[model samples]
Target: MLADIRSRLGGVAGINFGIGGPIAHRIDHLLSGARAGIAIKFSGENLRTLRDLAEEAQTRIAGIPGVTDVAVESQSEVPELGVHLDRERLARNGVSFAEAGLTLRAALYGAPVSRVYEGRNAYDLVLRVQEVAPDSIAMLERLPLRTDTGALAPLSAVATVTRESGPNIISRDQVQRKIFVTCNPAGRDVASVLADIRDAIDPLLEGKVGYAVHYGGQFESAAAASRRLLASGLLILLVIFGLLCMTFRNARDATFVMASLPLALIGGVAAVFLSGGVLSIASIIGFISVFGVAARNGIMLINHIRHLQSEEGVAGFEEAVWRGSVERVVPVLMTALTTGLALVPLVIAHDAPGNEIQSPMAVVIIGGLLSATVLNMVVVPALYLRFGRPVKNNGGAAGTPGETFL
Candidate 1:
């Protein structure tokens, strides 16, 4: 559909297509600080570089694969009629620039002299020139201007009115003049497309003084939120580690349980790759959740083995490991299956509106559970058997002659 529209509007200059409605655009602006799929910003004092660099960046971005509808933001050019006053001319005609400007404002632009109230609504009573105001320089040259001595003179005698183009609005960020090159992403992730855009433009813009480039739009929030979440994840891990140490009373036991985390990650990473290689906030949250569940399973397995050795009188390391693993197999599989199955519908409905956020999370959790449960049943027990020791009785080594160590 987009391709058809593009084809239909071929050769139309300065026209760029955009996706979504007003609300979506506003959301994009809120997320990215740019109201498009991508925003490449340029800043400088030179208007030429602002215009040239923005255009150049837009063109290069469009050339990159998966970039579409690239264009420099419009509304920067404004058609204005400038009245440049000549001081010598004004003095000779006994006219001041202020007086001439007031005359122009009152006559041509309809200055509001007073207001009239009709009930609750008030209307401006304007004063304007009756004769058709000049639309061209020739006509404006002949327009009358009031002088200080209460005389009238041709506006051309005191000033020059010329048609020119200027910015309707000047926008600044961090006290620097800025222009935005807006574009949409097609057939690719926003992050990859942004990288490509930067790659293509950075070298060309390198070594230029007083000019800088900024990227804005959805990726802005994505990058920031990802950074914060990563930090939070680290903190969560530290807290989890501390809690595990308290629970087990042995650093080695805690470390062995945490070791199973990598096993869980294998499936989660595979799921992300298989579903869509996008790592969103939802996906990160899912990984965090995965850590908790994976840790629980590891703790459950290790604790059961300890119980068998200390309470159930399981004789050998291999026998205790096998018995504990077999005892917990049903419970571990049940827990993992129930959680994964509950998210199956979301995983299937990948294209639903809100599912964009939920689906990745579901996929990650489900995949992590599958691998974590299997590894908990197999690898975790092996780790425990290798590292764990049975509780000592009054006699050391269970059957040796009475001996104790401090």
Candidate 2:
């Protein structure tokens, strides 16, 4: 069936996780993280006697989302183990089907036969062989069979044992039989898609199947980490913006400096995605670095624009803009080159923890700085030339039109 399914689907990369017996039981933690495929379990009056519920569970679990495959390890062919019971060995020891059946019943059957009265409370006495003592196949082989001569004989002399390699159990948290019903999203976020899958299954989970379900994986981790990174960045950005306001002593200039962040972020995010990387913790931290770097470049450009307006006797927009951009070009390039070069070690280092922290950050900073530097050198200066028309000669160099207008 798996071969047929694969054939029907056309060629695609896949990882097979199912193994017969109780192996699925150990996969609960791992399953929580599955982005694709299904985990399964089987339980019924028929399965009540076997160690292999995993195949049954998988059959049912295949119905869950993101589950493309529904293969059962237990159900997969093991033809030799499929041979009928050896009745010839049974007859040799006078172990006819009826007698052997009775022996099996006595070995496995349990019932609350009677209650014993003591003082005040009566407790029911349930009869069952202690499982660990004698119910196992090994113990059963050593069981004494009564011969026609009334002699006790070992049952092992009658029947040979063949270990059945099949499903053992499918359990969740040490109880209940269960399989994973995975949800695989085409393009949606793993977290959002998993949530949608769970929501869809809410009304669908009939507990009548006698199993449990769960969700987990990369999406879960990403959602958690994204929340943390967002909060941290917001706090840091606010703090940095506040410091800029304090240092500049002018809210207008500080606002212009802050605009550099948007200038930097566009290129940084584009580069990150182009590199085939997600916005992981490393990437977000890199993004935070962009803010500081962009702000620094903005400050430099603004300072030069002020100088061009004041000392250079720059009259109107274009002259101040051109002079500001040209004069600040060498300094901004030096600053960016120095910082970018310093981070080269992090980009090349593979195993260092410090390298992990710095690599994405350096990449983001490098990309954002390159962008913002160009913008600061070109657009910012042009804007300064256009808008920073200072009415001077008496008091002081005038601020830009936007600040006065605001």
Candidate 3:
């Protein structure tokens, strides 16, 4: 669709196209707003030089594959009608500068002379010369101006009227003039596209004094988000570990429980690979949720085994492990099944409205649950039997010694 639109608009000049995405995607961007595409900002004192550099950068970026809608954000030049005043000519003609300016303004854009009133309405009645084209230099030069001597003189006697080109709009950042060369990436990621853009424009910017180039837009936002997510993930893991240690009252048990996180991630990663293989923000969030669920399952099984020995008067450590695993099977299966079934719809309708982000997330969660549920039941039991410590009841009932769960 984008290619067809570009082809149709090929003949039109100075046009920029913005490609929109799903409604949910647009709403997400609106709520957490950021500029789209790659924006390279060039800042310098000289507008002409800055404009030239921006155009050159734009041309270089346009050659790169997957780049589209390449354009300079600021238009450097636009047609303008200029009236250059001659002070000497004005004094000789006894016409003040203000008088000549007023004459030209009145002829081009009429001034309000009086107000016309109806029963309940009032409108300005403007008076000025008619049948004169404001864009015609000849008509402007022939405009009559009042002189101090009570006589009329041609505007040409005090000023020269000509058409010229000047900057239409000037953009500034941090009190310095700047121009942006922006483009949208089609089939490539923002980082790779921006890297190619940097490589293409590096040579052109070498030794360019008093000028600086900065990259922004989607690339900037993505990079920042990646850093933040990394930090948050690490912090969350630490917090989860701390809570586990507090709950189990031993670091060994907590570490064992944390092992379920990696098990859960194995399925999550596989699911992402199966579903378009894109590790988006939604996928990361899914992984976080999966970690919590995996840890909770481990905690439930381990705590139940300890409870059977310490509180239920179980005879032996091996018996406690067996009975605990068998008893908790139903609860664990129910938890995993309910959550996975609920997310099945989202996973199937991945491309449906408002499901773009949630679908990938659902896939991760469902996959993680399948792996964590099976492994938590089997692996946690084997590991506990081999290494988990024996528990003693407050009532003086004790299990076999030298047995370690951690």
Candidate 4:
């Protein structure tokens, strides 16, 4: 039912709207942050300003299409202070840190001096030098300090009142102060939504402030992994082809085996489309399984053809190819079917919804195997028959005494 809706509504292209491009995060970093270098000041004031910006940014992000749950951090703060003590001036005025602190506390919040007890209730008439407690900077500065020589000095004489930022909890990565906002895409692929989020953010954040905003979520990790996976798969294919050539002593057999890969992938990609799914972790895993299984099926068919040509003294190449494919067909089909059946549970039962997971992998493998099984029978044999011409051997080193060559 869901598949039908997507089919009518623009197919996978509309779905691609949610996939993100690779360079989104790097671009985001360059725009929002001052520099990638070490920042000496990740102070409370700096972060508070960042949080305010983030809050505004978060609001803007929430309004964009396909975005949900926008949240940010970096809001560290100190108590709203009216600090009077200046460390430099205190030393010049003959005041120690503790001494200045004690005087300031006494003047601001005068201590209890007297208590009167009654039978039913205890009442205390405390005497404090200052009637109204000094809560404001102006009042606190008026606090009188008795110097060591019996001289009364205003706290203003020793300290300068200033409001400054402070630091609390700090977050870092690679020993560099780091901060980021997290968000979920609403019913969309992480990659596509990430792209949309970046586009919405770029204009608003071009000249925001000192800090930079980066998108670091599961999507980024998966996309990176996907690129690695592609490279790994290609590397595996090249290695396999090289190994096959060495084993068969002929590039012809190796080419036959490698040709099976394209058909195998066709089924995998088709399965993803059929299931109304994205190119997800599970799909990639399925691709891996498909490649391995398809390659194995091709190898089996190729090995059998090579075996028949050398061992059975098969004179005709087409006959050898036909006999080899016929022998391997049942086993290949059975292998493909058994594996496809094994993946049924994953395709049917989704442990976590909204994201294509192991189920898509199962789907891809099943579909790829379905296509590979048929192609392995026809494709591998055709390539072998075309190239496996009975090369004239002069009963010499070209055809080794007991060595089999395809």
Using lDDT as the yardstick, the better of models 2 and 3 is 3
Sort order, lDDT high to low: 3, 1, 4, 2
Residue 181, model 2, lDDT: 39
Error of 3 at 55 (Å): 2.8
Which residue pairs show collisions in model 4? 18-192, 19-191, 19-192, 20-191, 20-192, 32-212, 33-212
Which sections of candidate 1 miss by over 4 Å? 1-15, 21-23, 32-34, 43-51, 76-79, 86-104, 110-134, 142-158, 165-178, 203-211, 274-276, 315-318, 337-355, 392-406
Residue pairs of candidate 1 with colliding backbone atoms: 32-217
Ranking by TM-score: 1, 3, 4, 2
Cα miss at 80, model 3 (Å)? 6.7
Local distance difference test scores for all models = 0.80, 0.57, 0.81, 0.67
- Indicate which candidate wins on lDDT: 3
Model 1 / residue 186 / CA error / Å = 2.8
After TM-score superposition, the amount by which residue 401's alpha carbon in candidate 4 deviates from its true location, in angstroms, is 6.8
Per-residue alpha-carbon lDDT of candidate 4 for residues 1-406, written as tens digits (9 for 90 to 100): 4335434543443121112334644443344332211111222225556555556666776677756434454445664445657777766766677877776665556656677788888776655557534336676677677766667777788887655555566666555555556554546666777677667666655665545655555665577789999899889888998998887677776788888988898888888888765788778878887888888888898877667666666667778778889999889988988898888877778655643467777888989998888877887777777765553333332332334554
The TM-score between candidate 2 and the true structure equals: 0.51
How well is each residue in 162-221 modelled by candidate 2, as lDDT tens digits? 556544543434554444433233323344445545554444436545434455554555
Predicted candidate 3 versus true structure: per-residue lDDT over 164-216, tens digit per residue: 88788887889999987767787665667778998998888788999998877
lDDT of 1 at 132: 42
Q: How do all models score by TM-score?
A: 0.77, 0.51, 0.68, 0.65
At residue 403, what lDDT does model 4 achieve? 41
TM-score of 4: 0.65
Number of colliding residue pairs in each model:
1, 24, 7, 7
